[model samples]
Target chain A: MAKKSIKIRAKVKEDIVTVKALMTHPMETGARKDKSGELIPAHFIQEVVCESGGKTILTADWSGGVSKNPYLSFKFKGASKGDMVKLSWADNKGKSDSVEAKIG
Target chain B: MNLKRRIVLKGTAAASAIGVAGLLAPRAVLAAWPEAAFTAKTVPEALEALTGNSAASESGDIKIKAPDIAENGAVVPVTVTTSIEGIQSISVIAANNPVPLVASYNMGEGALGFVSTRIKMGKSGDVVAVVKAGDKLYSASKGVKVTIGGCGG
Candidate 1:
């Protein structure tokens, strides 16, 4: 699979940068069943990390209990316009992707 | 898969070796992922595995923001913020989910005690946010009703 799983936006205002990201995922909780009534195996992002200019700002540990195509937003200090902010995620199945966006 | 993880770890290490700015300062130590905690069957068990405290006291200082009714259990927005100082970590639990523990975050020094994310719900139930601060744990909870079950409901 391609590493195009995340869409991110960041904007800096008054020295603080707010970041919002949308992740593409099924986020299956393992308890879900298909139309055929067979259980769908668990497939969900287990880790997410956000960084600004090569520095880690946030790291998250998640489970199947997280909703599908999860959206996340957070803020950090000391960011400037046009700075690169990268967001990455790793799933329970060992699939992972990362994307970078410039602070607007 | 192992190779991919190894590459990522190597990149992090390389960044640390360069000794970047304060914002990028390498943590003296980062805690290992607590796999056992997230796998716990019960909420108390999960909490005990993560914070060593299953009997966390409820506190008004901790706030959990979630909708009273979630139209889609597949994606419910949840935000947790606390006024407590010296917060060490925050954990989110969806009581009705097959695996109740939704997410957990470790707070580094100078990090804010606030987090916002989307979580899944198998059904209508209480969404709990637990904060560990200086050996004590505090939590806040709010009931959320799911109109469309996320876990094949």
Candidate 2:
């Protein structure tokens, strides 16, 4: 399956860049099975790391309990215009995503 | 000649039956995808992963709006809002599912500290909303009674 695209809202506040990000993911808990009656192994994003200009701002380790298509709102201090912020996560299946946004 | 045609007809019928069953099954549990997500028996074990020491505290500022009784376990609408400022994020956890985190939202600066989304509840259980602003975490919850199991009837 294709990776879900992330929607980010970035702007400057008090000379510090802030970002709000929302991702589109089913985040299946791996307990739901197919029609065949076999248990589907759990598949969910376990860890999410946010970075700004190569500096780690926040790192989150999420459980399979998160609802589908999770959204995250966070801020990074010292970010200025033209700076870039990155969002990424590692799924239980070992699939990873790296997405970026330019500070506005 | 008659046996061959009869066999073919039987095959067709069986295939169609299987197809219909496949469609209905997903539509049901697709809403509540995880049954084992909750039912975490212990708090420490449950909070061990995903935001360690969750040990959430309840407050009036964190308001969770959801239906008291869900007619269909497949799709339940849940909304979490907060009165506090400098909001950071909101997460929903179903205590009975095998994996408990339902939804997590990070509310950046200028964004509303409110979100509404649909989740599949495996069964009737405690639905919790946890909000983190700065270093403080606040939360709220409600009991939802699941009428029909979302995975299948």
The prediction achieving the highest TM-score against the true structure is: 1
Worst 10 residues of 1 chain A by lDDT: A30-39
Model 1 reaches an interface RMSD of 11.2
Give model 2's DockQ, 2 decimals: 0.09
lDDT of 1 by residue, B64-89 (tens): 99999999988799999888988888
- Candidate 1: which pairs clash? A67-B120
What digit string (tens of lDDT, one per residue) describes model 2 on residues B20-133? 334333324233222222323334344444345567778888877889998876667777767778766667766654345655555443445666556667678878888777
Candidate 1 regions with alpha-carbon error over 4 angstroms: B1-31
In TM-score terms, candidate 1 sits at: 0.80
For model 2, the chain A TM-score is: 0.83
Error of 2 at B146 (Å): 6.2
**Residue A44 accuracy (lDDT) in model 2:** 59
